[model samples]
Target chain A: MRIVLIFALLFAPPLNTKLGAQQKPAPLEEVKVVATTVLLGQLVQTIGGDAVDVDVLVKAGHDPHRVLPKASMLLRLKNADALIMMGLDYEHAFLPALLEKSRNKNLQDGGNGYENVGKRIAALEVPKSLDRSQGADLHPRGNPHYDLDPENVRIMAMAVREMLQKVDPGRSAQYQLRWTEWDQAAKQEIAIWKAYLKPIAGRNLIAYHNSWPYFAAAFQFKIAGFVEPKPGLRPSPRHLAELEKTMQQADVKVLLMESWVARSEASGLVKRSGCKAIIAPLLGASKQNRSYLTSMQALIEMVGVAHGLPTIQEFKRDAKEEQ
Target chain B: MMAPALLAQQDGMSQGAERRFDPAWNPAIGVALDAFGMMVGGGDGNNEANDSITLRSMELSLSSRIDPLAWAYTSIEFGRHEGAYEVELAEAAIWADQLPHSFSLRTGRYLADFGKWNTVHMHDRPHPFAQGVRQEFIGGSLAMDGVELHHWLGIGDLPVRWSVGVGANFAGHGHSLLAAESDEDLSLGHAHGANFATTSAGDFGLPGFAWTGRVSAQHDVGDNGYFQWGASAFLTAAGLSQEHDAGATTELFELGQNTLAIDLTWHRLAATDSSSDTIGTEFFWNQRDAVDETFDRVERLQAVGLWGFYLHEFNAHIGAGVEGAWWEHADKDDGGHWLSGAEAGRQVAIFAAWKPTEVQRLRLILAMNQPDPAAAADSILAVQWSATIGSHSHSLDW
Candidate 1:
């Protein structure tokens, strides 16, 4: 009877171990993705969700134009399972160097894990000619700010969804599920943005640079002229005078500027035109705007406020009270 | 030893869409015109920068990718020779990437990745004058014909690079920037080592041509600051004279050389690339075997030099800076022959620059030069204009 008890105890250990293995499965390994910009990081995180870990190459609040792959950025890239980029040579003059220096062939152009979201969208404002003298900064590739158009973002989401599934097939269903939910959220937020900005519909806005064509097209706003005579050149006094004339004619009340652009150049225009200037950061400017949809909502809310309309926050509070 | 390949920094003048190099130029061609007019010694005592407004070092560079794995670059320079223009090959090398273990290989006649200053061409210096320490110890620049292996230590967060090089014709120094005709400095050539080559009877010379090793790295100091540091060592031997015998060649008088250089540079770049402030310092120590013309025998002489500078760019078009360079004989000043002329000297300068665009710059410099402590200081003014008309890529020495 004692030997029988000992045999049962020893065999019972193996029985419990087998039951533990069968009952509690291990979690799938998360794919590591290195995304170039804060906006792209937000997009990757949305689609990857819990199945992937996203490392942002260009940290938030830093100058987006100043993306230098220092050691830290490079190391993260080297270890990444996939890399997401905003193509169209969007100051990606450093991309070739980064890939070569990282010595990670998997992230190169032809590699399996390389993803360029630019390919997913049809670009706007593609120059007919590559004329260097025509303007201050004419991108040879069409406007890369297509993501500003929420529709283009949906396209980018599809591409990201496919990329994550390809890199981490075991979590394909999880990524697809997150993508589906993200699509719904984006659609709802975009509708709110359109309604919030409806008061200023068809109003021509003055922008410091050529960053807002996609955004203007997506919303109901009209863009008359820029503070800069050309796309990237400083606004000459003559150009500013001309732009002011256009602003008066178009009744443009908002002057939208990028955060990296110097404000001193546009300060005179602000006073002369008496238009409210809105400085839109690249992305992830405020704590509340931590994600892509939130960042876009924040930008839309600012424009609404500038036009003397209620912000999205007020709109949400009113809806809650109604309910 | 390794020039940090600075990522494409949007030159504020370039606006947002400007590509630093014109990729449209199929085989990327670059040209630079460097001309400066300075004191020509208009003051109290002898100092450097005696050239009287000369257009020197017009470099024409050509580069193309050799294949998927390699690229070749060649630079030819045209300068005044015997009161006429002559052309010389500055650098011609092929760099191969895609090697195993983050290794890159470069082979040809190129600047030996020696000190930070030695690797930078004269056209790229902020000021027109070469720093005194590096200029006196190793001449304006040290070019080598051989192979260099570079390894990017993908260690942790910082990008650390180590490079080792060995080759012949680790020729003497830069000729255009040199003061005058001197044996220590030789003309650039594939067989330049032959200038100092002799028979094997003088086994004093090392069989290997020249050897160099360097380790360099950089890190971000703050939100808008970058710091780069480098340490380098170089060794080479050359024969001073060869005795001719009746039938065979005789023993040679060989001078063994060793050089060590350390440098640190910190840059406070504006949020955009519109403006920046730079503060930098470089230290050099050189020990060499040379024929002491006084005693007519080989003597080991050591020298040390230090240079520091602070430069601030007010905006895109304007900048001002102050630089001071000092060097002296570390060994007893017994008046050696080969290097005695440049013994102990110091130069200080304050200047302002007008960079109208990315490709055009004009600078006005006011400098005080004292070759020796006992000598009178020479005050001089310089006006320099530099222009680049094509795509130029400099693996930068930031």
Candidate 2:
């Protein structure tokens, strides 16, 4: 009798009904999208509006490369209508395991609702060889921080709108209209930022990681050096000494650092190089600046003001008056 | 910059055929090499090799995504048992995630998802020693040749996962280290072949599968800290214990066993990479029908064990820890009441490790062991070198 009961439990409805998988997923009232980051989620929110419910997988101040797959993350992915991700191995460490374990099929690669936003945008620092003789190389495909560039943001936003249309086509017109408006406003903001950032456009700045290349390319600034000798590796003392010498010899007087990166990580370099450090958000990190557009504006103004330049708000006001 | 995007997108599409067959998309090959050297001072002659070197324990593992619906993992282990070495298919499992209600089904031959310790491989253990109670009760670790279903749910910020497994190993058979050894006459986790005088009765075999259940919960104390607690239960036929008078069997009894365990772990990561402190504790209580052949008594034997460890990683390259274990022999028969000189014994070890990289580790351990409570403690010094090359993956162990 006990053996019979054990076999009965093994083949219970919840465990066996979907052995091969549900032929058709139950209809969702709203497209439940799981975005890999807050920045991507904000894009889905802006373009998707009320037609979609977006769940951010990686939380604020968390590193995507070091994500520890947890149960809460799995629960969210189990029923997701779609998945938005920054490809190029941004979610490499954790996404594969979680996605395979998740019940949601739409989020899988090649699925209609699966979107890799980074692929549509430009990539930088594509490695010529996959060599580990130097140190830990987290970014093997290319730099995944293309969202740092506003033009790339446009490409990613376009992707979010298209993915939503594919998953929840009833709201296609609503998404397309919002994306058009978003692109226009983003253009205006980028114009204002460029005008104010023109002074430092050709100047060189030291960065903490390889995260700022897209931002540098967009704004026409040159990255003089980095605190970390290699990507994902801590800055050694000897490397810091060499970086300081480069900063002094090259007359690079500004250092750009991301918030959430321990300032202590770059403190030694900051002291030796005598460069003014400007800490900026890594997009949609705070509740107040969760929107990509607002975070970009805040990031530009913080860097400009720190370098003794006037705020871009004045140029934004001027542009509004001209419009 | 815009040119790179356009050129890369075009190049990417052209390389689509090549990408499909890329080695990166296929199963990852991983190999682990483990070697240990031990020097013992004194013991009750329990271990055959008091001063010896073992280089046989090695593992090769493969893992990759099968498709959008599943992921798979398998491991081949080469290990030692009683001065002899053999290769064992330690684990082979396919995880199907596209089930209903957030339930994941894992089917294959794999570690029993019971408490924490059973799933840990010998190479992954904190110290190089036989687990006391677990060795006596289950084996080195428990392996199940069957299916396990797992479900994850959350209560606010706390996350919990539960797993239930049914397998033949649960039915007192298989080569899982914790399954002890393939079968009754073959291997026991730490075989006490001398205790049971009667051979297993051919007609006494039970046909039911073994059952295993586990519930684990996790709480994030802070950004850098994690806490986990869990409980597990295992029910199975524990083989036979018979009463024999002057080498003639008088009564035969089937040993049915019920085992319960609880575990706790706390890990705190320092800001620096690979620098952290972790403490874990596990306790087990097991009950089984047994015949104290010495006393000619048939009764339910109750046994217990406690094991704990504290590991501190000083940097990316170095770590140290202390592990201590205490267990009461399953036969019970304590001093004065039953047939016993002593019922409980303890082992403690202090170890230090150097990890050149994530895949490489070399460690040295100094241990004081009381194989028998009535015997004086023995001290042993050991050194181990373990390394994993190629693809390596594991849970965060939070």
Cα deviation at B351, candidate 2, in Å, is: 6.3
* Residues A117-160 of candidate 2: C-alpha lDDT, one tens digit per residue: 87786689887877655556457778888888888888988999
Q: Distance (Å) between predicted and true CA of A279, model 2?
A: 3.6
Quality class of the docking in candidate 2, CAPRI style: incorrect
Which pairs of residues collide in model 1? B37-B53
Top candidate, metric lDDT: 2
Model 1: which docking level applies? Answer: acceptable
State the TM-score for model 1.
Answer: 0.81
Chain A TM-score, each candidate: 0.84, 0.86
lDDT of 1 by residue, B62-84 (tens): 99886889999998988765345
lDDT of 1 at B106: 94
What's the true lDDT of residue B155 in model 1?
A: 55
